[model samples]
Target: MLGLIGIVMSSEDPNNTDQKTRLEMLNDSVIKLDSFIEDILNYSRNTRMGVVMEEINFEEILEEIRNGHKFMEGANKLKPLVEIIQKEKFISDKKRIIVILNNIISNAIKYRDTSKEESFVSVFVECDSKKAVITIEDNGIGIADDKQEKVFDMFYRATKLSNGSGLGMYIVKETLEKLDGIITLESSLNKGTKFSIQIPNQTN
Candidate 1:
């Protein structure tokens, strides 16, 4: 269905303004459907796989997530404020951690409060010999207190601002559990949201 919609949209007459606008909306829907499908597949795969913990440089992962080519355009516009208070080798599933960071960071950008004079995301990392704690805070339209607890549930969407598959947070929580990690959230309606993730450090 999505592929058919894309083909129809692509073949539309560019001179027809009304048709163009409708087609654009249809295209957006198709893109979202595609994302939803991908997220479901990822969630299933990660759930079935065993965690492969390895020594990884925490800062390097953050750098890749913030400045990576995939996010360069959005990061440039969002101007996320990332402060790595501690950078060191940690033991965890690198890929899963990246997925968690990417989803939260992207949500911060996607749901930014345009009403604010300035929109920003701040990331703080703190770790000890036992575990690593990552706090991602965003000055974006926040999750209402009533809805906060459900954010990690599969197919749960907190706000209309969410465009992608509602599976992002679900995947994050499931992946963390696989890694023996946990997450918590704090938010006030219209204020912002903060997510704190803690993963056990298995380094010897």
Candidate 2:
């Protein structure tokens, strides 16, 4: 009876361990998913919420984003490779523009190749007669050629190791489409990724 009891306890120990591991993983996944959902809410609120559109300063919006986000700060903590090549002021809704810039910049910071010696990211802004273009590029682990299209899909991750809810790009795509804009991606694995966004200057 004593031996049987000991064996039962031993058997249960492994089960408990497995259960604990699964629970922790689930919790982490939930947290990541929650953050992703919050980002979507922010994007939605920027457009759908009861805020009237007004003439906004893009430089101020970018500055406010730079000042508030801790993630970008950390990205530049080690030798500071992230760079804003150009900044521009545009006449648009402040909240909406902020949401668009924040999402793109946040991902650039988050996906940076921390292992590299010169981890860097860049943002460029240009406005012309017809439209405005914003480009965000990063020297991070880029997407594979085949999986590039999948990045825009909801809840799609290229690898099992990705610790994310996989909704960032999806939200980005949806937001741009809603705003009558288009986003283009150029990427190569181990090289990097560049996202070029073009939006019309006229108000909707």
Candidate 3:
């Protein structure tokens, strides 16, 4: 529908300012819709595929995620602090880990409290022989205590502030479950949110 509108509007007289403005708006909507569809596809693909674990570097993955967000609209205003407390390689699905990190980071940026003096997202990783523990903290608009539990539910939008499909966290939880991992959340309204995740050091 949006595409058809855009095509029709494109044929309007070039001098018709009103038509041109509407066409531009429709084009932007189409771009956003395309992105939303791609995210849903990625979520579905991750859930259907079996986990493929291999030795992977924790820091390298974090750097890639950070670099990917450099061009995002408000990325510069939000500080992304990444720290690997214990440098260790783990056997895990690298792609899924990327998906998990990307979703969390994306949320941190999307839901940031612009009223604050500054906003930041911090990632900490601690790994031992048995498992790797990751803590992702974001100084964003925190989830209300009442809505915290539903954040992982499919299609649940915790806040009206979101323009996304609300499947990011759901995909995160599903992907983690497939790897026998656990995730927990903590937040205080108006302050921030923290996610503690644990994945096995070795998976069968």
Candidate 4:
């Protein structure tokens, strides 16, 4: 009886309980911090690596981007709808182009309203003889006017709670600028954000 009583007292000790709970919480936080670091590394690698330009089919790129988001939604048990309007093909780095679309659309889906079942994302592409324009728009929560520019800054999260490294738009900006392209954003809080990139067909 005394042995059993001693074990019970040891288990019920306030210091031991507090220490066990603290360790568990710290372990969970460490796991989360590790994940955060990995994400940062991946984002940095994507931005730092350069690709060679080639004949890239705009439709195919759109499809690839759509398929990627679809897979993500499926994994997260969410339904994603993607719409694309393409007018022409552009000559650019296929991988880089895919990166731009994928990152932006992923963020859109990530920020989508979880309370709503009919959430969807849209992508549009247009082109002329000189420049090709790609636009990605989402129906999720939008960015504030003042935060629009900050969205393209490295590690700048428009909202701290957002599930992104904040490097998506920054990478997009760098990649487009490398291709002599420009990105513009039009957004309003609660309305959604639209990112449009215009790249020259020929770098002369």
Candidate 5:
């Protein structure tokens, strides 16, 4: 799909207004399809395998996630603060963790509050010998009070802004359960959303 996007973009003519609009639409469609396929693959991989216990490098993981999203459209408009206050040997399923973080970060960019003067997404990780505490917060178009509980259900979508495969959070919840982790959500409509996560270090 990305290859297709590149081909479509390269063929665009600067003088053709309708062609530019159509090209943008085509590009967006392919991107969404690519995302949906990736989401499905992630879900399948998590369910098929056992959690691999390994030491997770918080700083490296955060940097990788940041770089992955930098090419996204609204990502540049948002002020992002990602910090690791304390990091020790935090062991968990690295693949599952990346899937979880990627889905959450992707949503932050997708559902940004266009009405606001500025948008922001913050991620902080604190870890000890036993567990890791991760907080992902974003000032975006937040989940509604009524839809919060269903966000982790299969094929459920909380916001209309969702162009996702609807399996992202469901996969997150499933993966957390496999790792004996806990996740809590707090949000106000049109205000913002925050996810607080506590995952035990399997090395113990």
Candidate 6:
């Protein structure tokens, strides 16, 4: 990748279309490799480390996640609507929860249904002291009925739109298992996808 970058940099016509395309491709490859490495590290962390309990600030973290992806293409189209109803303080593994939400949200953005004029991702959370119920819904290119069951399976790519090694949802499943959480999904071919995840709140 470095050699390719050097070549692109040293090109006689710096603005050449072919060189620009090659550089773009190289940049994409780097991003993909970085995502894969992060996934691996996440897998190790979720599998090996014990859950560290902490108070969860839902609104703050959700906003943080939204800000992190504002630079993504089409992010502007998918406005995130967040609704939080919390009667009591929610306690859980903060990092793990962030990981789960980030993966799902990123996928929603990447596989968004471009045919629609209005697209949105809504996150609704209702929690008491016992557990947290999170629903993330997106108007995007959804998984087919047949493929939905196997989405959490290792390296399963339900659609060609998937670019990763398909470990995103696998790691999500693993992390949820570690947290004693339950995840369910609903989707249509081109309409959208909704994910409902519930995890027990740890009392510290």
Instruction: Return the clash pairs for model 1, or none.
Output: none
Worst 10 residues of 2 by lDDT: 78-87
Candidate 3: list runs displaced more than 4 Å.
Answer: 1-31
Q: Model 5 off-target regions past 4 Å?
A: 7-11
Candidates ranked by lDDT, best first?
6, 5, 3, 1, 4, 2
Instruction: Give the alpha carbon lDDT tens digit for every residue of 17-50 in model 4.
Output: 7766755565555544654674566467665877
lDDT of 2 by residue, 1-204 (tens): 323434554555565877557555655565576676777687567457654456555566677877756433345642323333234334444566677777767766666677787776677777654567888788877888999888889888875556666776777777676556889999988878899998766544
Selected candidate, larger lDDT, 3 vs 6? 6
Rank order (by TM-score, best first): 5, 6, 3, 1, 2, 4
Deviation in Å, model 6, residue 25 alpha carbon: 0.5
Better of 4 and 6 by TM-score: 6
**Most TM-score-accurate candidate:** 5
Q: What is the Å distance of residue 59 in model 6 from its true position?
A: 1.0
List the pairs of residues colliding in candidate 4: none
What's the lDDT for all of these models? 0.81, 0.67, 0.86, 0.68, 0.87, 0.88
Could you estimate the TM-score for every candidate? 0.83, 0.71, 0.85, 0.70, 0.94, 0.91
Residue 54 alpha-carbon offset, candidate 5, angstroms: 1.1
| Count of clashes, each model | 0, 0, 0, 0, 0, 0
lDDT of 5 by residue, 39-69 (tens): 7888888889988988898888878888999
3 versus 5: better lDDT goes to: 5
In model 3, the worst 10-residue window by lDDT is: 1-10
Q: What is the lDDT of residue 169 in candidate 1?
A: 92
Q: Least accurate stretch of 10 residues (summed lDDT) in model 5?
A: 1-10
Comparing 1 and 2 by TM-score, which wins? 1
**Model 6: residues with Cα > 4 Å off, grouped in runs:** 1-15
